[model samples]
Target: MKNITDYSGKCVLVLGLAKSGYETARLLKKLGAVVTVNDGMDLTGNQDAEELITEGITIVDKEHPLSLLETNELIVKNPGIPYSVPILQEAEKKAIPIITEVELAYQINEGTTIAVTGTNGKTTVTSLIGDMFSHSSKKGLLSGNIGFVASKVAQEAEPEDTMITELSSFQLMGVQSYRPHIAVITNIYSAHLDYHGTQDEYVKAKMNIFKNQQSKDYLVFNDAQRELLELYTVNSKVIYFSTVRPTNGAYIKDDAIYFQEELICRLNQIVLPGKHNLENILASIAVCKLSGINNEAIIATLTSFEGIKHRTQYVTTIDGVKYYNDSKATNTLATKFALDAFNVPVHWLCGGLDRGNGFEDLDDHVKCVERMYIFGQTIPKLIDFAKKHDINYEMCHDVKDAVSKTAKFTKHGQVVLLSPACASWDQYPTYEVRGEDFIQQVKSME
Candidate 1:
């Protein structure tokens, strides 16, 4: 591995002491970079922050110190910190380069990186791609959004290893000169409006993943996302994947997954459900084929690839009523897809912190659902919408109560689905925690 310039004695400001922030500070300190960690919240109860402080890293919490920005030569920013933040604005004015954890990892690795970014299906595609490469002779590292920051993985990755990263729009926003050899945008939908302010801005943020790619690199996108595809101005070799089989790139035809180069997998044999997943499978096929994996390996791996849990995961049948934990559906479009995937009468558990989303798009599913169990901060708005549409609905204080009530209301041949069409921050730390709580509550009924 090439030893890049040592950060020895360079002042680095690490903002937002979350997992990525703390990891950056630790790595910077190890590389001899003078690091000051700053978070806007106190570390009285945060174990992660306490651990970093114990390691002798300078800690600033409760508020971001303007002085920290003034003295720093480089700012390692968490994706959560918007560019509009006063401290970041000041840093920009002073001409200090603001870098994200992914960029830092990219600079250090300087190897082949395959980044996956989209409003939905990114995690599934990223994992599937990583699995394909890992199953083959090539070593691969799976990180970013799915789990672990890229910087942490790059520390251990070999030069020949491929990094299959699931990047969020927020992470892509802060990236500069971080080009991936293979970049895939599965699909774009209305999401994170609160952070990006508008759909256009959010789409632009996702597009940044391919902004630096050259003609030699590969850019995979869903032909279905017409608006998103039209925005790309890069000269990279483009590949399109679609659920409705296309003439070129990767596509599905007659229940079979195909690449432009060869047939990959029989789509009917795939264990993962939903039309959305077929598109994800297509993206994975494109990535695998481009990386030189044979058709036999792609089909074998996908046939055995059980879908990720908490994502349209089947919970159990209690008193003949099936329950699915789709707590990962944190956006209206995702929940819409989930609802469409099932034809049975649905006791839809929906509501959470509203990300400026509306319920109008869900009217078709709302009609199909037997009843709606609304919870979290957005319950009132959902309830109001239901009332206006004459949809049957009830409110619960939390997810457990919602699940309990849903089990009671459901009957034989019916499904109780926890597909909150909004963010889970109102009631849980993450969608995973919310999904786990739902699973536990449902299992307790049996």
Candidate 2:
């Protein structure tokens, strides 16, 4: 790793002890920084905290004390922690340089970075890029919001390695100089307004992915959002990706996918479905082409990649009814993509933590939804949507309840889709848990 700054004798506070926070603390301590970790949870038996204590890193668990801010020169916060947190707000007033682990990863990373961010398709595009690299001559280290801690991945990455990172707007907001060599924004839409407080703030947060990029660096953007994205003054070279029309980078023309003027693969050869997935594929192609990856590797990866889990992932077919888990659709736009993928009559399982956003945007997209299985905190909002569309509806306690109810009512050739277009915190702790519950429930029917 490149030693960009000397952290010796610097007092740094790591706010929130999640995986990223734990890794960040360890890395800071390793660099001789005076590290103090603060988490609201009581870490009395936490193995991670114990390990850190052994390394002489201070653990300030149980609560986030305001006093810690007075001593620390810098704050490394977990991405999930909002800036509205009192400690963070105070830090801002104190002129502390607050950042997420993504910034720290960039500061010390020896490898080239390819960061992907968007409302929906970033995870798929990031994973596809990494998968493409794995099948090719080059090496790509997959990390960031894709599950692996960015700082942890950066710690082991070599100079020649390509860091394919799936970044969220939450993570991007804290970045200062975290410029990726090849940045991709699959598509942008209004999301996470609960944390950001406004649509514009959320969009601005996602824009941080390419903020520090130079003219030599590449920004692979979704062509559909050209008007909104182009509003920002990007210093980097813009490479457009479109499933609709020809672009400067990757596009579909004459039934085949092309990067610039060179053919990558035929449209019929792609295994992943949906126009959203096509947008994801286009963005991946742009990044691969910018990285100089061979078309063979791209084609091989594209043809075989079924999809990542919990994002319109097919679980199984029971009695001719196909079940799909898309619990990652934590917003209306994401759910729209999930709904758009299926032409067959759908048992649309949705609703969760309402983020105060209505599902009216999904009015035109839910034409194929034969029935609505609603659950969680946003049940009333989803019920209103179902009523407006004159679709049959059922209220359930949670995802498992919804899945079981849908399974009984679903007819042959119909789809049982668990695409909750709201945050899962209303019931399950995470979307992953909700998705796993949906999968297990569907499997039990067999």
Candidate 3:
């Protein structure tokens, strides 16, 4: 990594003025970089843009003026901005070094950094790792794809602190020098094909999480992931987490959660449920052990942890029906895992932007689904799946209607789960927003 202190007087162009880009711009500006931020939105006295403008950071909005590239030493691309964009192409022509904010955050961070990435459980493992650090009395700031930008946390990071981050394939694809002190891959699965162009490319993108790690750096991984086992190689010192076998890192055997040779806790003591969650817990335990957290603290955190807001979050129980908000399940594999977590009959609130991949992937799990409330652009595709699987289903306008409709069919002790096997881009901007909408709609039932 280049000297972060040398950013002063360097010309840095930040593309996309969303929270990620905007914060990167601020950090660059703080480092004395002559920074310019661009977004598709027109410049206005909108508080955030205006605040940056007043900070003497240039805010160019509404369009990407290619001419501005003449003097740039670096371009920081937001994870959301596609490389196919003309301005980015122009930057490539100019041979400008482009990287995500996390890369820059790593360049500037003095704290020990831990990054978690995978197709399904990044958020859960990331949150649990951060919680473990909190119980160990270490300062752990959680960030990245969970809504906190890494660089935003880096600005306040001290050497004594630790940074726990959740990374997505998009963020990892653009990373250049963003190696973590401790890196983790929960597991890899086919996801984000739309952005990655292909499964191989997506797998390669995720493997970037460990690209720069050295032998001294630690890699905690899911030993049970066949996809990971078949593809990708890790150079860092590896510690494995699994449910099937004894591992050097963490594992579960006969209901006991073990770290290395020691028993951390029993599986029944865990507050979070499901086999996938057991995988998440094992991964989190491995990370916590690497961070030197004691077993008692780890067990305490595990017993109290209810999981993050969206992924299988229990919203409420009304009229003997339990509603779980898993709006974060943005792909079929995630939805499948969510289903595997529950043995009870589920009235699933599913569907979203159709990726054309169809429902063949989730066919086996359809038997557990008592009723499917389909919604969004993928209604027809899911409805077809419902028919093929011979499961009862109904079409709904959105999450609100899905919740209301499911309520009528849900009897006591049944589950109304919002585990969309598709992304939320069709109806809402983010999964967080969609999950909030689902929570509000569920609350409306009373």
The prediction achieving the highest TM-score against the true structure is: 2
Q: How much is the lDDT of residue 168 in candidate 3? A: 90
Q: Residues 121-178, candidate 3: write the lDDT tens digits.
A: 8899998988888888789999899878888888788888998999999899888878
TM-score of each: 0.95, 0.98, 0.96
lDDT of 2 by residue, 377-407 (tens): 8988888888899999999998888888886
> Which residue pairs show collisions in model 2?
none
lDDT of each: 0.84, 0.90, 0.87
- In model 3, which regions exceed 4 Å deviation? 1-3, 226-233
lDDT of 1: 0.84
Pairs of colliding residues, candidate 1: none
Candidate that beats the other on lDDT, 1 or 3, i.e. the better one? 3
Residue 321 of model 2, lDDT score: 93
